[model samples]
Target: MMTFSPQLEQKFAKMLTAYPEGKKRSAVVPMLIYAQDEVGSITPELIDEVARRCEVTPLQVDEVVGYYSMLHRKPMGKFHVQVCTNISCLLVGGMELYEHACKKLGISHKQVTADGQISLEEVECMGACSWAPAVEINYDFHHHVTPEKLDQLIDGLRKAQ
Candidate 1:
């Protein structure tokens, strides 16, 4: 059985209104974000509910989820730290910073902290090559991140939680 909290259903309804009468499918991305905002992750149950609400197939919703990097099929920590490991970032100490962060947390990239507060991942790019060695925690960007900066960023996120 699939269902959404009333608030989520309301959000979906409102988002659908923004599109043409038969174009509710156009709201898939934003609806997914709404679900993600409410549930913390884009679980399979949420996908089915989104599909049902949008009058689309579950496979269509799954495809949308897979195409978007921001969407997650599994649960993540409270703070998801995605470090850019692309060419520019790598040239600017991205690897070292990632390694240092992993060592500090005693977990590698794509692993969550034991406390379930932080999940670290190595990403290709964040479109901020000029700000090489950047990281995004919960989609908030931190540029020119060194090991010290990463530590400071983690500290701030931890405190906020």
Candidate 2:
């Protein structure tokens, strides 16, 4: 069985109304976003719930969740750190910066720290090649990062919180 808050049900209902009859599948993406926002990550149960509410199949919800990188399939830290390791970033010292972050945080790529404050992931082309060796913390991008600056950046986030 799946549980949903009244708010989520209402939001899902509104989203379903936006599509024509029998086209409720169109709301999968937004429903995934809403689910992720509520639960911090998308789970099989959540997908099933969304499917039920939207009158679609669970596989349909799964497809939308799998297609979007922004949709986290597993639990992530409060701050998701995505480092660019594409051609442009690699040409510049992205690898070194990534290594430094791993060393400092004591976690490898695609892993979250034990404290659950941060999760590190390597992504392709953050589209800031000109500012190579970049990382995105949540929604903010930090460019031209060096080993020393990485420490400062992490510390700054901690202090801000």
Candidate 2 clash pair list:
none
Q: Write the per-residue lDDT of candidate 1 for residues 39-119, one digit (tens) a residue.
A: 888888888888887889999999889898778877778889888888999998988988888887778867788888888
Q: Which pairs, if any, clash in model 1?
A: none
**lDDT tens string, model 2, 65-160?**
878888888888888888888899999999888888888888888798887889898888978999888999977999898888889988886776
- Considering every candidate listed, which one attains the maximal TM-score? 1
RMSD of 1: 2.3
Per model, how many backbone clashes are there?
0, 0
- lDDT (Cα, 0-100) at 130 in candidate 1: 97
Which lDDT values do the candidates have, in the order given? 0.84, 0.84
